[model samples]
Target: MEIAENTALVVVDVQKGFEEAGFWGPRNNPGADDNIASLIDEWQSTGRPVVFVRHDSSKPQSPLRPGYVGNDFKDYVEQRRGKGAGRELLITKTVNSAFLGTPDLAAWLGAQGIAQVVLAGIQTNMCVETTARMGGNLGFDVLVAYDATYTFDLEGPFGWRRTADELARASAVSLHGGGFARVLTTREIVDAAG
Candidate 1:
């Protein structure tokens, strides 16, 4: 659980659009923002690299679409802008994985000699999970801050519904058990960082 000094914190898709519970349905982890803010503070204070991934939804009516205020980073993340020394990066992605984002996440991380990545953001079962899996597959040591990510309830095409908490737990199990990433809580990561 030792966090390397050069480890990168890749925050994925924590945008204002996600605040619209009406659009995303009920969500789990109301304190995800606080957890993410704490992690960012720790990373900035430690001078570790921080990568911010933004999701610019291509869907016309989506709240996260370009030109909308909802597409902007949340106030907490926005306020931390330029605080990561020169180790800060902003990636714009339309997909689920930050690795597939603009400016090339993997290549940039490689250039910085960062092999470890910690993930935290909105949608625990979607963008965050995808980025963690892809990061691990690409040979990076990946850690997922489970309590720093949130997800909404989802319904299957066949009429079954899964709660947000259920989905989050499932994602944790999948990532950890499948060997894609080490899923840990925000407290655990912060303690390790110390």
Candidate 2:
């Protein structure tokens, strides 16, 4: 899909916390971070708006809790944001949906007149999915980078175990079928951005 001039790249929850040992077990989309970083680079180079979302967990034991090393961004993201200055927007959340948290992401986007949003980051079934839903509901054109986000295998009710790949596909279907967003690959988003 061709991106509008008033588009923002939303990078969600790509923190060191998610990288904690076995915190997210057996995730798929191995090169998701590389794809996300590439998107950030492209956004920076093209002078498009870029928003970084971080999950600051309320659970004390969670690695994403404030003051923990895991709460900080991965080195690559940190470096990129450090140099971005006013071009980068950082939104922190303590909940599942970025739009539902303390920050008013939708309002910020509305203020910026961002009609289209490109999403990339971690936990395809969680933060990424929730944010996409909210963005869609708020009437923004939400494009998700399927390969640029990853999630761990999950143990569901009734003793059902879902692999990371299965969860990823589920996320895609939920958003696509629900008309919340259009799921695309990292390369597709990059090529379209070009």
Candidate 3:
């Protein structure tokens, strides 16, 4: 698929808090960070719009809560943001969807005349998936870079544990099958961008 020049890359919740493996349990897609970095590089080099979404958890004990070290963006992401300052947009949110964040993602995209969005980031089944669904519903062409997002294992209500890989795969299936977004690998997105 050809990626339009106006497509915005929306990266969600790629914070240091996710490094706490014990807190979030084991995660899948160890190469997610590298893939995300590659996407960021491609977008920046191509002068495409880039939006970074940060999750400032409202829960008191959450690692991503305000004032915590974990609330900071990961080192590499921070560096890229600093280097691309003024050209990139940062959306601070306490929720799952970036579109629901501060400054209004949909409005900003609309103002820029952007009708397509590419999503990447942490918690594949949560923030990334939610943003993709909302973007699609809002009449935007949403593309999810599945390999650039990762999720942790979780225990269900019935005490059944689901692996991180399983959760990530399920999210991709849901997003693509439900018509919320097109799910593609980071490589596919990057190649198409070129």
Candidate 4:
């Protein structure tokens, strides 16, 4: 449960579109903000790098399309901008995976000699899982903040409507059990950062 100083917190796609009242927003994960906000503050206090990934949908019908009010980050993230607080690295990606078709995040981490990544953000089974797997494959120890990420329910092949909580469950099982990453709670992360 110890978070090393060389660890970087990678917050993936915590945009306003995910927090707003809509189909894409998280309805099952009720306290996602509380978890993510606490981790942000903890990482800031520890002087660790906090990397933010934003999904910019180029499609006209995409939720993060240009000029959309819900395309920006939420209030918790907006209030901390330009304050010169933490080692904040903001990058925007257009794909479901942050590592694919984007700037060199791995190179940036390599330049800083960061060997571990703590991931937290939206779409647990999508972007967060993808980034965590990539980070692990790239030789970085990956830590996934379980409660800090959110995703909407999805329809599967069967007659089952999968919920966000269910998606989160599958993500933890796949990422952690599959050896892609270690899943932890926000409180454990804060305690480790201390």
| Candidate 3: tens digits of C-alpha lDDT, residues 1-194 | 98998899998999999999878989999999999999999998888889999999999989899899999999999989845422578999999999889979999999999999999999999999999999999999999999999999999888898999999999999999999999999999999999
Candidate 1 yields a Cα-based lDDT of: 0.94
What lDDT does model 2 reach?
A: 0.88
lDDT of each: 0.94, 0.88, 0.92, 0.81
Looking at candidate 2, what is the lDDT of residue 127? 92
Clash tally, candidates in order: 0, 0, 0, 0
Candidate 1, residue 193: lDDT: 94
Model 1 CA lDDT for position 176: 99
Best by TM-score: 1
Candidate 2 C-alpha lDDT tens digits along 1-194 = 69876589999999999887577688888799999999998888778899999899999999899999999999999989845423567899998888876568898888887889999998999899999999999999999999999999999899999999999999999999999999998898888878
* Residue range 1-194, candidate 1, lDDT tens digits: 79999999999998999998888899999999999999999999989999999999999989899999999999999999797754999999999999998989999999999999999998999999999999989999999999999999999988999999999999999999999999999999999997
Model 1 alpha-carbon miss at residue 51, Å = 0.2
TM-score, cand. 4: 0.92
What ranges in model 1 sit over 4 Å off?
none
lDDT (Cα, 0-100) at 171 in candidate 3: 92
Clashes of 1: 0
Candidate 3 error regions (>4 Å): none
Q: In candidate 3, where is summed lDDT lowest over 10 consecutive residues?
A: 81-90
Candidate 2 lDDT trough over 10 residues, lowest sum = 81-90
